[model samples]
Every structure is written in structure tokens, then in C-alpha cells.
Target chain A: LAKTTQPISMDSYEGQEVNITCSHNNIATNDYITWYQQFPSQGPRFIIQGYKTKVTNEVASLFIPADRKSSTLSLPRVSLSDTAVYYCLVGGLSSGSARQLTFGSGTQLTVLP
Target chain B: SAVISQKPSRDICQRGTSLTIQCQVDSQVTMMFWYRQQPGQSLTLIATANQGSEATYESGFVIDKFPISRPNLTFSTLTVSNMSPEDSSIYLCSVYGTGLNTEAFFGQGTRLTVV
Candidate 1:
């Protein structure tokens, strides 16, 4: 498993774009980057995932640099409901099976009204 | 996506007692996992519940402490035995969706508070 580092907390106001970066210096070639959001008293929800370059969905955008050592999750027009903890995980197929995801201390996003 | 239902969403238990958390998936899945999240901490993998055979636990977690059972493809249970105040946390059950780059679906989680 690749270890990830992220900020402990971030603050933003409504309508502002929030970007959270995660560093995984020892990322493996087969590893894929995934981001999950967790609200209070709830399970983590899938935000976005990407192997390289950029991937976008209606909810968020994932940008992986060419080196693939780091990735950023970009949330557009944030709202108060966007406040949650975000986790970045790096894992891939191991022996023909998906490796169990190991979560790190996530970045807590606090969206102010 | 799979739907998971966990019984007894929240509970307050006394020390030395045991609590069994049940997880049921709407459809059959090949893999089921149990995780624990301590207060103000990240989630930790407890074990991977394998059907028919014994579950494979992660480091620092033992079968005696956190026994897991997967009798079939859609149902599993995790028993927290001989609980203490330190055992208070949220337990979540998860399963992998179909495909190579599939996402995992998780249950609402069981919030256990030991007194």
C-alpha cells in the first residue's frame, strides 16, 4: 500500500472552488488513485478515480500529473453541504484481485456559509 | 452498486459483553470486508470475510477479538467479544462491486459505545 499525505483541514466559503491535494511519492505503476468523501455518521462515498491525466464527473474532477506521484481532487462551487472528510487511496490489482483499500488520515473540508 | 443493510445501527454496551453486528447485501458478492473507525480517526481494515472458510484478519486484529463469519455470498457477521471502553467505535461493512475498476459499497455502519 502506498502511503498518502494530505492537509488536516481546509476552510472555504460557499461558491468557492476547493482543491485538495494528496501526495503518494512511492506510488506503484499498477496503482490507481481514488478519492472518497465521508460525511458525519455515514460511510465514505466515492468521489472520483483516475489512473493518469484528468477525469471528470458531475460531482468532482480528478487530476493526476504525468509523474502520477500526486493527485488533486477539485470540487467546483462548493456549498455548506460539501463539508466532509476526503480520503485518497492508492491501490490496484494484486494477484488477479483488487487489493483491500487502506485509508489514511483524510483531509477535512469545512465549507462555511 | 450494491445495497448493504446493517442491523442495530447504534448500541451502548457494557464492559465484558459481546456484540454481533450483522451485514446483509442485496446481491451476492465475492468479497466482503469489515472495518473499524475510531473517533476522530481514519478507518482501519479489520478483516476480509471469506465465504465457507475462515476470515483473514489484518495485523493487530485477531479472530478471537474480532471474529467474522461469511456463511454465504450475501450475508456476514462480525462479533466483538469481551468488549472494553477502548472498543467503542463505528464498524462498517463493505463489498466490492463488479468489474476490474469497480467501487466498493458500504453499509450505514454500527455505532458501538462501550461503557
Candidate 2:
């Protein structure tokens, strides 16, 4: 398991791009960086994942440098509904079983009007 | 992606009572996890439930306080016993993907309010 660090909170206006960065200086070779979004009364939803470089999805994009020490999640054209807490986690599967996931205090993004 | 249905979406329970949260996955999975989220805080791993075996609990969480049952691949339950005001939080269920770099899917969490 790798520990992750993120900003405590961020404020963004609607229609703006929001980038949340996570630092995992001790990330292992097998570790993958994953981001999840959680709304007020709902479960966390997987937003994006990346092993290296960039990966884009319908909801967000992930950027990872060659060192894999850190990664960023970019949400384009944000809306008020996108205001939520985002979590970044680094881990790898062990022996084809799902390993325990440790979550740190996430970055709380507040999308303003 | 997995579709998880968790029962008792929200409940207000009395102090000293217990509440059971049920998780049902649409498909079979190798691992099922339970997590607790305090208000305005992040999530904490409570336990990992594997079918046909004892659940592995995390540190600071005891089996006596939070017992888990995984009778099959698609179903599991977590019981919070001897509840108190401090026990009020959101409990979530999650399942891991089979691929090496796959993401995990989560269920709509259960909001337990011990009054």
C-alpha cells in the first residue's frame, strides 16, 4: 500500500477546468493511481485511473509522469453538481484477490456558480 | 463494473442497539469490502469479507464490534453492534475488479444515525 497526499480543498467556478493533484512519492512499480468522487449522500464513484502518461474518460482525465511519484485528475467544464470530495489511492492486487484499500483525507472540491 | 445494492439506505437507530447492513452484488466477486465514513471526513476500511472464510478486520476495528459475514460470492453483511452516537456514519460496500489495474465499484452507502 502506498500513502497519498492531496490538497484539503479547492474552489472552482462553473465552466472552468479543475485539476486535483495527488502525491505518492513512494509509489511502487505495480501500483496504479485511481481517483474516486463522492457526493453528499452517495457512494464514491470511480472517476479515472492511470498507470502512466495520460488516460481520458467520459468524466475526467488522469495525468501521470514518468516517475509515477504524482498524478493529476482534470475535470473539464465543471458544474455545481461536480462539487464533491475526490480521493486518490495507490495500490496493486495481490494474488488475484482484492486487497484492502486505504483512503486518506480527500480533496474537497467546491464548484461555484 | 459491478452493480451493488445495499439495503437500509438510511436508518435512525437507538443507542445500545444494533443494525445490520446488507450488500448484494449483481455478479460474483473475489472480494467484498466494508468501509466507514465519518461526517466531513474520509473513509476508513473496516473489514474485508471473503466467502467461506473469516473476515479480515482492520486495526482499531474489532470483530466483536463490527462482525462481518460472507456466505457466498455475491452476498455479504456487516453488523454494527452496541451502537452509540459515535457510531453514526455512512457505511459503504465495494468490490474490486479482476484486472490488475482495474478500478473498484461502490454501492450507495447506508447512513446509520444512532440517536
Candidate 3:
């Protein structure tokens, strides 16, 4: 599993855009970048995933540079409800041969009022 | 996407006792995993439940302590035996999505408080 490094905490106000970056210098060729959001007392929810470049979904966007050493999760129009822990994981996606997902100390995003 | 339901959403258990957490998935999945999240800590993979065979546990976790059972493709159970106060944490069940480049889904998690 590729080790990831992220900020311990970030603060932002409502309607602002929040960007959290994760560095995975040992990322493998088959590894994919995935981000998850975890609210208190609930399971972590999948936000976005990408192998390279950019990928966007209904909730957020993932931007991976050409080097693939790091990736950023961009959340638009932040709200109080967006206050949660954001985790970035890098792992292979091959069925039956994929590596286990190892979570690092995630970024705690506090969306202030 | 897969929907997972975990039983005993929250429980307060006595030390030296055991508690079993059940995980049920809406659809059949090939990969089912168990994770432990200590308070104010990141999630740690406990084991991978393999159907029809013994589970594959992660380092620092053992079957005697966290035995896992995957009787079928869509259901599994984890037993925390001889619990201690140190075992207090949220236990989550996860399943890999069906296709390639997909995301894994997680259960609401079972919060266990050891007293």
C-alpha cells in the first residue's frame, strides 16, 4: 500500500471552496487515488476516485498531476454539513489482486458558519 | 454501489466478554473487509473475510482476538473476544464495488464501548 500524507486540519467558511492535498510519493503504476468523507458517528463515504488527470462527480473533484506523486480533492461551495474528516488512499484496483486500503491521518475539514 | 447493514449499531460491553458484529450486504461481493477506528484516530484494516475459508487478518490483528466469518458472499460476522477497555472503538464493515475503478462501500459501523 502507498503511504499518504495530508494536512491535519483545515478551516473554511460557507460558500468557499476547500482544497485538500495528499502526497503519495511511492504510488505504484496500478494504484488509484480515492478520497472518502467521514462524518461523526457514521461510516466513511466515497467522494471521488481517479487514476490520473481529473475526475469529477456530483460531490467533488479529484485532480492528479502528471507526476502522480500527489493529488488534491476540491470541494465547491463548502457548507457546515461539509465539516468532516477527509481521507486520501492510494491502492491498486485490480479485482482479487488489489492491495488493501490503508488510511493515513486524514485532513479534518471544519466548515465554519 | 453496495449497501451494507451492520447489526448492534452501538453496544456497551463488559471487559473479558465478547461481542459479535454482523455485516449484511445488499448484493453479493467478492471482497469484504473489517476495520477498526479508535476514537480520534484513523481507520485500521482488521481483516478480509474470505468466503468458504479462513479470513486474512492484518498485522497486529489475530483471529483469536478478532475472528471473522464469511459464510457467504453477502454476509459476514466479526467477533471481538476477551474484550478490554482498549478495544473500545467503532468497527466498520466494507465491501469493494463490483467493477474496476470503483469505490468501496461501508456500513454505518458498530460502536463498542468496553467498560
Candidate 4:
């Protein structure tokens, strides 16, 4: 399993773009970086996933450098509803097989007015 | 994306008792997982619920303690046996779709409080 490190917490004002970076120095070649968001008392929800470069979704954007040692989840025009714990995970999707999906202590993002 | 439904959204169980958390997916999936999130902590994988076979548990987990059952492709259950106050936490179920470029979908989660 690739271990990830991220900020413990962050605070941002509403309508700002918040970028949370995750460092995975030992990420495997076949691994993909994924981000999930979890509000209080809820299961983590998938935000975005990317192998390299950038992948954008309706909720957020994932940017991975060429080295793939790190990735950043960018939330654009954040709102109070975006306050949650953000987790960065590195793993490979081997269909039909179970892989150890390690979740690091996520970064808690508090979007304030 | 898969829609997962978990039973007994929240429960308070007596110490030394057992509580079974059920997970049901709207579609059949091959990879189902059980996780535990202690208060103020990150999610920890408990085991892999393999269909028609014994579950593969993580290092700190065991078959007798966190027994998991995957009777079919769409449903699985996790039982926390001999519970204690320390076992109070949220248990979650997640499934990875077999199709390409798909990600894992999670159930709402079971909040268990052992007293």
C-alpha cells in the first residue's frame, strides 16, 4: 500500500479555490491517485480520480505531475457545503480482486463565509 | 456508480454483545470491502468480502472478531463480536464496479456505539 501524507486541516473562505496536495513518494507505477470527501457522519464520497496529468469532474479536479509522486485535489469556488474531510488514496484497480485501500488521516477542510 | 444500502443506520449495543452490519448493493459487484472509522480517526480496512469464500482480513482484524459474509455478489454482512466501548465507531461498506474507469461506491455506513 502506498502511504499518503497531507495537511491535517485547512480553512478557506467561501468562493475561493482550495487545493489540497497529497504526497505519496512510494506510489507504484500502476497506481492511480483518487480523492474522496466525507461530511460528518457520512461515508466518504468519491470526488475525483486520475492516473496522471489532470482529470476534472463536476465536483472537483485532480492534478498529477509526471512523476506521479504527488497529486492535488482542487475544489473551485468552494461553499460552506464543501466543508468536509478530504482523503487521498493511491491504489490500482484490479477488477474482481480486492486490494488494500489505505486511507490516511485526511485533511479537514472548513469552508467559512 | 453503485448504490449501497446499509441496515440499522445507527445502533447502541451492550458490551459483550455482537452487532451485524448489513450492506446491499444495487448491482452485482466483485470487490466488496468493510471498513471501520474510529472517532477522530481515518478509515481502516477490516476485510475483503469475497463471494462464496472466506473473507481476507487485515492485520489487526480476525475472522472470529469481525466475521464477514458474502453470500452473493450483491450483499454482504459484517459482525462485530464481543463488542466493547472501544468498538464504538462507524462501519462502512464499499464496492468497486467491474467496468473500466469505475471507482468505489460506499454505503451510508453503520454507526455503532458499544456501551
Per-model TM-score, in order, reads 0.97, 0.97, 0.97, 0.96
Predicted structure with the largest lDDT when compared to the true one: 3
Tens digit per residue, CA lDDT, model 1, B1-115: 7899998799999999999999999988877999999999999999998889999999999999999989999999999999999999999999877777737778989999999
lDDT of 3 by residue, B2-111 (tens): 89999999999999999999999999887799999999999999999888999999989999999898999999999999999999999999988777864788999999
TM-score of 3: 0.97
A13-44: candidate 4 lDDT, tens digit per residue:
99999999999999988888989899998998
For residue B22, give model 1's deviation from the true position in Å.
Answer: 0.5
DockQ agreement of candidate 4 with the native complex: 0.62
- The TM-score that candidate 4 achieves is 0.96
Can you tell me the DockQ of model 1? 0.54
lDDT of each: 0.92, 0.92, 0.94, 0.91
lDDT (10s digit) by residue, model 1, range A31-77: 88999999989988888889999999999999999999999999999
Q: How much of the real interface does each model capture, measured as fnat?
A: 0.35, 0.67, 0.65, 0.53
Sliding window of 10 residues with minimal summed lDDT for model 4 chain B: B96-105
Pairs of residues at least 3 apart in sequence or in different chains that clash in candidate 2: none
Model 3 agreement with the true structure over A54-94: per-residue lDDT tens digits: 99999999999999999999999999999999999998876
User: Count of backbone clashes for each model?
Assistant: 0, 0, 0, 0
**Docking quality level of the chain pair in candidate 2:** medium
The deviation in Å at residue B18 for candidate 3 is: 0.4
Candidate 2 lDDT, tens digit per residue, B64-101?
Answer: 99999999999999999999999999999999866765
